[model samples]
Target chain A: MPAEGGQQALNGAARRALDAVERTGRACVDSISAFGYGAALFAESFFWIFRGRSIRQPVRLTMIFEEMMQIGIVAIPIVTVLSLTIGVMLAIQGIYTLSLFGAESRVTIGIALSVTREFSPLITGILVAGRSGSALAARLGTMSINQEIDALRVMGINPVRFLVVPPLVAMMVMLPALSFLSDLVALFGAGVYVSLDLGMSLPAYSDRVIEVLTVNDLLHGLGKSMIFAVLITLVAVVNGAGVTGGAEGVGRVTTRSVVQSIAAIVITDMLFVFVVTR
Target chain B: MGVEAVNSDRSVLVEVEHLVTHYGARKILDDVSLKVYEGEVFVIMGGSGSGKSTLLRYMLALERPTSGSIRVLGRDVVRSRPSELYELRKKMGVSFQSGALFSSMSVGENIILPLKEHTDLDLKTMEIMARLKLEVVGMAGFENLMPSELSGGMLKRAALARAVVMDPKLLFGDEPSSGLDPIVAAAIDELILRLRDALGMTVVIVTHQLESAFKIADRMVVLDSGKLLVTGTVEEVRNSSNERVQQLLNRRVDEVELDPEAYLKRLTGA
Candidate 1:
């Protein structure tokens, strides 16, 4: 009986070991499958975008307009306010440091360079990701669980073309537009802080901002914003369009969309800074 | 009308031969072979998880079978290229169980979707066509309303309107009468018949509702446990000698026999 018990225990251990190996294998397969699915979806979106553009598949102009208004126009007030605050805070911190070195007047150059080249685009990307990226994922995820995506497929409509391209085009247009507005507002904010709090002339602050900002800086910031736009749109769409498991899945993927978009934005921003600053 | 009054010269519209499908390790359809005739209501009836919907998906060319062939409109669905499938799909229409109307678009927009995609009809013509279909579905004045505003029955009707708008050669509806009251269910069933008769489209409906299935099915295919149990006329199925067929038709659940020792061990966690 004792020998039988020992043999059973050994068999149980082997079974658990096999179970662990099976679980690990399943997880690996799942990860690879998800990665492959996301890549394929991304490629399909682009195929419809550039190829379908030339072929003249009916693009919904109204939807592009609507998404543009939602992502860019509706966001104007909040983006403007947040950018101005960041500008003021950057100037305040810079002014304190500059004062210690007796280089107070030079703070405008620092504020202008940072806001135009990095802060404006980065901040706009973060905000849009939280606002519009999450919205896209949540909306698409709900549509998916409701079988609207499958319905589109059965109707001979390409889901990527019908559902994804409008937001994509809207992002391409609006992200740069938002970034431009952010740049202007942040500069104005820095000017306000310099003239009022630091006792510098408004005209002098403006002159320094203009002097510090080069054509290269403006292009770099806009270029970064454009890439950020693509990342946010694609990540949100992939998460949303791939949702399963009904309501809870929508929530789960929505959270994933925001988290993934933000991480992608930060990493891309770091790379852009590394390359562009060099 | 009995079987004799229905024309016997109809051509086959959809053909499935020895079809097999699997979901992971579990077989979902096993050697399910059937034919759908043109201008007839072919109902595939089964309990949940019996693979009727999966079969419909295959017939619609949205899924591939593990083995065997499905030919819709004389084209092998498994071997068709994407472009070929798209062309074949244009000849077919499918109404989903949940209506699947674009929530963002009004009912009018949904009905005119296929027309806009496949035809160069002017906005006025599309609108008129959409209105005409809505009227046919008894939803004439509800075109401007969004999908969210429609009741379940109205949503299903509107979805049907959208499906038939392009006058497809074949119409596949999934669970048309599901979640409806018997009266509403009967009305949808009648609509299916009218569509088949008027449009001359082959109709394939996958449903679990026996009453609706019996009321409309010209010929029925019954599935159980991912396998075809029987396929025959209503009377033939009613008179079937097969134990599984009788079990299903009489709404009897099979008793599962378990070893008493094992049952007790599981229950007592010993």
Candidate 2:
């Protein structure tokens, strides 16, 4: 009887282990499937953006502008504030760390390179993901629940074209602009800190920044911002369009969109850094 | 259901054959087959969870069935490419139970969305068309209002305007009167009939409201537990002798017939 009991216990442990393995497998499959769907959505949105006019379904300029206003213009203040703070913090930190070696003046290279190549784009991406990505998810989720997406389909308006493409074009236009603005503001912030704390003149600081920074640095940050924009839009749309279960489902997908977008941005940033730094 | 009476002269617009659908392991539509004739008001009526809405979705080509075939406008919706479906959908319009107007756009913009997408018509012309549709739905001069600013009845009217704006050959309404007062429901019924008569669009409505179904439908199908129970005119359905149909019509609840062994198993979580 004791032996039988031990066998049963061992079987239970094996069953639990199997269940856990199955769960992990299921989660991985779900993520892969989600990624594939997002890719398809991205492809379709671009197809519509580029080829819609041939079929008399030209992407509406008005809708794109409206989306630009929502996703880009409305997000300006927050992006500015956050970028400025990051810039100041980076200057302070760079000064302190370099001062340990009595090389505080070279903080110019550090702030200029880091802000242009990394901090500005990364911080702006996070802000947009939180601000616009969550809203996009919630809006599309509510539309799914309300059957507006279905209505659009039945009306012969491809939801991807009518809905997704405008925001996509807006993001393409706006993210780089926002990132560029973020870069400038952040540089100005760092310059302010350098001038006030280190007794550096504004023009001297500007000359140092201009001397150290390359056009590639600015373009590289802009490129990363555009990539992040696509990532945010894709993640937001996938979660939104997949919503079910009414209002509660909308809320759930919105949260998931923001969380997933931030994760995507960070992971992609790491990959980008690896590639560039290599 | 009398073998789905065939009208030899009328062209069939929608035909479903041996349709089967499953949500996970549970069958939601079980080998259901039906046809919708052109230029008729056909209603699909069933209680909640009877797969009526699911059937409507299939007919709309919004979802793929697990098995069986659906043909809409002579196109195999299940096999059609997205471009083909879009072309087919241009001739079809659907109004969802919740109205489903784009919340970001005003009613006028929502109504003319189809025209904007598919046509290069002048903005003035589109606006005029939207206003005309709104007038037809008794929502005249309300085009500028947003969906969230409207009442339930007004919202449905706006949705109807949007649906009929393109003068689609067929119109599908899912439970148009499910959540409204009798007066408003009756008005919606009148609007559906008006749209049919005025625009010559065939109508397919899914509803469980017996009175509304009976009032609006020229012919109808009754579904129970994913199985089609009957397909006939209102009078024919009223006279159906099937026990379940009678139970439904008379509002009688089935008495529980418990199997002692099964009950014991359930109680013990066996």
Candidate 3:
């Protein structure tokens, strides 16, 4: 009887181990399929951008303009303040560290390169992700809950065409523009600090910044911002369009959208830096 | 159970065969079948969670069943591509439970959206069409109001205006009388009947309100626990011999003999 009990226990352990493996496999498959579904949705949205007019359901230019106003123009004050603050702090730290070695003037080089090639774009991406991405998810999730999306489907209108493409087109256009503005504002901020702290002339600081900044640095940051835009919009649209369970589900999906967009931005930023620096 | 054949002379606009649907692992609809005739108000009534809404969604082609054939307007909705489905949907209209008006758009804009998407009509003509629908729904001057600004009944009216703005050949309403006072609910029922008579549109509704169902429906199918209990005219359902149907009609509580062991297991999560 004891031997039989021992065998039963062994069999139970093996079965549990197999069950765990099966569960893990299924989870992986679910995730992969979800990712594939998201990709298809993204592709369909993009396709609608080009083909909508032929079907007489064009993505309205006025709608795109409204999105740009919401996503870009309305965001200006916050972006400017945050980027400028970071720029001043970076300059202060750069001067203090470099002055220890009697090389404080090289602070201009550090500020110009870092602000143009990295900090400005990264900050703008994160701001947009947190602000617009969360809003998109909430709006879409609520629409899903209210049956507005389903209503649109039954009306023969494509939600992606009417909803997703405007924000996406606006993001692609606005992210690069906003990054350029951020780079300029941050440099101006650093220039102000240099003039006040080091008793330098504004023109001299401007000359130093211009000498250090390359066209490629500007282009690279703009490119990164564009990719970040795609990531933020994609995550928000997917989460929002797929919401279930009602009001609480909207909150859950909105949080998930912001978190996922930020993570994607950071990881892609790292990959970008590794590639470009190499 | 009281089951009667649908009027063959009217011609069927929607036909479902052996439809089965599951929500995750739980069966929501089991081998259900029904037919809706053209130019008639066909109601699907049941207790909550009886899969009436699910069946409506299937007929709309908004969702696919696990196994079934659904023919709507003579097209096999199960296998239609998205493009074909959209084309089919142009002739159909649905009013959701809670209005579901696009919050961002004004009532006028909401009503004209389908026109803007599908037609090349000038702005003036589209606005005229929207105004006409608004007048029909008794909200002629509320075009500039946002959805949030409207009361619940007004919202439903605006939603109804949008649904019929395209003059669809078929209309589906999911619980149109819900969440309203009895008077307002009756008004909605009256408007639905008017739409059918005025526009010559076939109507399908999923509702649990027996009064509104009886008032608007020419024929209906009553469902319980995802199973169809009766499909007949109002009098047939009212006189159904099935105990469950009688209980539902009388609004009486069901009495089930308790199994103590099973009850204990359920209570204790065993």
Q: What DockQ does each prediction reach against the true complex?
A: 0.75, 0.87, 0.85
TM-score of each: 0.93, 0.96, 0.94
lDDT of 3 by residue, B1-270 (tens): 322344666778989999999989999999899888888899999999888998888888888889989999999999999889989999998999999999999999999989988888999999999999999888999999999999999999889999999899899999998889998899899999999999999999999998899999988989999999988888888988999988888899978899999999999999
Report how far residue A126 has shifted in candidate 2, in Å. 0.8
Of candidates 2 and 1, the better by DockQ: 2
Alpha-carbon runs more than 4 Å astray in model 3: A1-27, B1-6
TM-score for candidate 2, please give it. 0.96
Q: Candidate 3: how close is chain B to the reference, as a TM-score?
A: 0.95
- The DockQ assigned to candidate 1 is 0.75
Q: What TM-score does the predicted chain A of each candidate obtain versus native chain A?
A: 0.88, 0.96, 0.92
Give the distance in Å from residue A143's predicted Cα in candidate 3 to where it truly belongs.
0.6
The lowest-lDDT stretch of 10 consecutive residues in candidate 3 chain A is A30-39
The whole-model C-alpha lDDT of candidate 2 against the native structure comes to: 0.91
In the range B105-173, model 1's lDDT, one tens digit per residue, is 999999998888877889999999999888888888999999999999999999999999988999989
Highest TM-score, which number? Answer: 2
At residue A127, give the lDDT of candidate 2: 89
lDDT of 2 by residue, B1-270 (tens): 443445656888999999999889999999999888888899999999999999999988889899999999899999999989989998888888999999988999899988887777999999999999898888899988999999998898888888888888899999988799999999999989887787788999999999999999989989999999988888999999888988887888888998999999999999
Q: Model 1: residues >4 Å from true position, as ranges?
A: A1-36, A53-56, B1-9, B268-270
